[model samples]
Target: MATSKLHVAMYPWFAFGHFIPFLHLSNKLAQRGLKVSYLLPKGALPKLQQLNHHPHLVQFFPLVIPHVDGLPPGAETASDVPFPLHDLLISAMDKTKDQVETILGNLKPDIVFFDFGRWIPSLTRRLGSMSIYYSVVNACSMAFSMVPAKGLTLETTLDEQIQPPPGYPSTTVIIKRDEAPHIVLVNDPPRAASFCLRLTAILKESDAIALRTCNEIEGPFCDYIAQQYSKPVLLTGPVLPETSATQLEEKWDKWLNKFEAGSVAYCAFGSQITLQKEQFQEIILGFELSGSPFLVALTPPHGYSTIEEALPEGFKERVGDRGWVHGGWVPQTLILEHPSVGCFVSHCGFGSMWESLVSDCQIVLIPFLPDQVMGARLMVQELKVAIEVERGVDWIIGKESLSKSINLVMDKESELGNSVRNNHVKFKSIFSSKDWQDEKIGTFVQDLQFILESGK
Candidate 1:
């Protein structure tokens, strides 16, 4: 008798940070000959259409996102909505429970992996489908935020919250209370309350939990989560493509080809965080001061129109051909893999971090948001593979400090620079080892098969 292949459904939070990782996992499952159904907001389909090249076993379902009271019309994904209006989008997503249920009925998947869907586990349980809560963040953050659930709520003081969770050493990945959103610390506001309630529900109802990280990177925390939840916690091996170096566009190829090998600094902040005019100038000037050829891609803040408007006076003429400041988009992965690229200046988003880890590039991390700070700490403090640009007491990083960080990462012979480069090389070997990735992901798949077969 031919064994039946399990069918799986995936529902990720509306943000690209979450959506892209989920898509990668779906592709991997499909490649392994399992039927995979991916649920995406209608507005997000175009982006996926560009990346997904018609995998045979993966099906894409584009669902309309209903408008909520405060969210603007047609604002479907997190990128489309402003930060303040994010709660409205979450509310709108909750309204899709009926749509999700209708689709699940038709798909009849054996299991569903979900992010930020409180009702999904109960719904899947009632329908005889197993539910797995999928976290896209690193396990250390999950250990702090998701493990106790109550530790992050209103009663925990700023001082108390900064301490590492119990069983962890005091020095391990401690997050400052102010680094996170106020709602994350206090539970009063409706959005915060809603978030807490949903997290509580998902933890109670889900059959298992999964993270897009490896045991190598977060083994202790992964073990902690399994014991705390009394359920299987699977590690998905970062779900990174073997190589991010796709074909380069001609314009970049022409410019990048002129630079000497390992002489260029590439800077990009992923789509979410927007930089103010002053912060943008500091980065540009810092690059100029480092005396390295550089290319940067930035998205303007809400009102700004172009890079020129944001740049300081004479900025272009001063650096002339040595620098490139592009406003909207740049081919980041291609640039990172380019021979001339020596260093990556990044916001430390997990996607970018994974991309940098795979490349030979050294790292200069300047994290902008709360979660980004945790990721930066992981790289600079925990992993020791990246150097962080130091901010002053006011939490403002000046051009001098930024330039120093750049120089340190780019310098081939400096003690600090050599240490960072050596650590990065060690990580690259581990990240690139086919044997390691195969073992981790293969174990996860075997576990899933066991779950499916046992259910039958």
Candidate 2:
């Protein structure tokens, strides 16, 4: 039996990146017999139904999302619009406060898990419930940017940000100079100037804090967050749900099978990281230059409507059947597990970081955001399981640098190549174990029960 019959409410940010992970944890809790009320955009219901493995125990509460000024009509999730319009979507989410409050009042969940809503604590408190600020991002990212002592502001310079947040534990895993722009929130709207400030406020006000990480990979960083925040820092242990039963589509299956085992390099930037036209051309050309069988799945880059329009000159004629460049979503988990896929070039989204960790493919990082950069650092600098693509001063990746990073990892004889391959295998073995993953989820439930029942 579950530790208690506690009802948990989840309200993650509207992004599918956030929605999927939140539901993964919800399924784990539901498996233990706890009930979950997942609050999400109304349009996401159809997509989420396929992922919710426990329909009997988990219930979806599709939110009636309100349209706000500047957001395109029906852009319910982050993937529906360009990255620049994220704040406008956030503004729309905030406008749903009244709708959410009514739902919470009716559902009367014992505990609510939320992120990106600084108002959740107050709203839940008023409803006579406890709140957990469950972060979908990793502890290292939160520690680096969102800690209270960071004093993060729009004026915060790159030099200052590269320095560790006060009492931050990691030395080698800091963001590089070029990647700092993603963190400082320089281009954000006035209301969204610095997410760290808002996140810090939410952490301070929340009854408890939780992250999607385990101490094995980011122990000191998780510890720092718990210590600095002065709250229970609960961990969900890199909760990547199993998608193994989902087979790769036939087109990709046939294409990948033609290559020798571990010869094809697959590159995907998760939902949010769209490269500029110049950068996109450089990356695909870099893949061609590598002379490896390649698959590149990315959204159309900025200022372009389609992948074909953005391809480098003569790109199609030169690398005709050897390269597969997709402009739409492919089954990433299935693609990663394909026998012929040797390397994964990714933006290191927190979810992607965990997925990469548990996969057999060699990892290469091309992070475009702060959280992503932090996740990359753990893999590259600390664990030595991956290498990052070096970017020019403008933070644009060079074709040569991208190809070199892939070739370096794919080269079996090189020292760095051998070391990264060995490390990836070592970590993969640990994370891929079903029992280890289950134990983490079990402990997570026990702790939540303790907090909810005992009111700790």
Candidate 3:
């Protein structure tokens, strides 16, 4: 079959950060008249169905998440559990292999796109389908840590992990601390080891590798990946998000309207990251210290059931009406597009990274995960389009440091801030160009056609 007429099925790790981008790519493919089967848990269906603009071309295939030993009843995705319980959820996903096989056998898609499912390639190959390791993380991160040349293994030390893999393109991204971020948090060597091993294994096994990036920003890194893995690295461009007709919620819109244009700071750390109480409070205090009217959306802090209950003493009274904190979903894209939001304080997750770039906001990054840290560095060092909030002793983010970073970008006249602001404007123009994104998507389809015909 011609690639244009091909059907592609996607199965990402059970995290919004992962699957949401999968859906975005599906939307891109659907626009080109390609059919897509998005396989995800039944719980994620309602939300994703709403986001499915091309219902006829893009269909949702729901799967049952089998109950794991320790997980709370009905816990499905990463959002339903804390970080420590993630491995159990992955186990549950593994148990669904029979279900996945049955679905694919019936659907028989031409190509399968997956991340974190190491068995997917073998399974798809048995079914005579091509499997692409569709990664939503930045290429630099994978190239640095998980590339074949790195020789990383379960026994790799923190010292070795900090070093760049042989022939990695950039020196900007590194594990600056004595311990990896996960070590500081989870401290479970086996889980971390299996994660690294499984990810690299999938890279080695997949028919091709795909990323939601254009060559403009990460070309060299992508090249490094292709060379190291000895596989075709497909670029889907930025897959700039499809515009949503949904308006920003009335409450947030009305509050943001109170601030002047280019005056408010917006802080959010995507879905998966649940910060400690100390860190969460410090971040809120950081915004207060910045003295900029701010809106912060975050998950509930550790040991706290609600964000309001987690606040430091007298916090609401001290900040007065200048600040608001919500522990639920907010329309991030619309908020970024709002004129009042001048600074975007983000975790540098891949999805948020693109959103920040395309929006007219000064970027401030606070990254904890390896991929996020690398992405933050890419923006801060390579692109010079953003600043990272500095971490002090033992990877602790100080409120003053966060305040300083925000103020640096918000202050309009600061030399460093001006440079980043100008750079952001330049890149934003390039990224937001519809013709350019569409062209990459076109090339992407052609590449798929070549792969399907030639079976490389």
RMSD values for the candidates in order, in angstroms, are 4.6, 4.3, 4.3
lDDT of 1 by residue, 1-456 (tens): 122387999999999988888888876666566788888898898888655543677788988999888788799899887777777888888889999999999998989999788889889988989998888777776665665533554334324435444333233333344345321322223444455456756876788888888877788888988887888887889787655446999989999999999999999998987776777777778888889999988887546888788787898899898899888778787888889999999998888988888889989998765457777878988889999998753355678998899888788788999998999999899987877766766777777887667762
TM-score of 1: 0.90
Off by over 4 Å in 2: 1-4, 154-193
lDDT, candidate 2, 281-396, per-residue tens: 99999999999999999989988889999999899999999999999999889988999999999999888888888888889999876678778888899999999988774566
Which prediction has more favorable lDDT, 1 or 3?
3
User: Against the true structure, what is each candidate's TM-score?
Assistant: 0.90, 0.92, 0.92
Error of 3 at 379 (Å): 0.4
How many backbone clashes can be found in candidate 1?
0
**How many clashing pairs per prediction, in order?**
0, 0, 0
Q: Which stretches of candidate 1 lie over 4 Å from their true place?
A: 1-4, 155-197, 242-245, 454-456
Ranking by lDDT: 3, 2, 1
Give the lowest summed-lDDT range of ten residues in model 2: 167-176
**Model 3 misplaced regions, further than 4 Å:** 1-3, 158-186
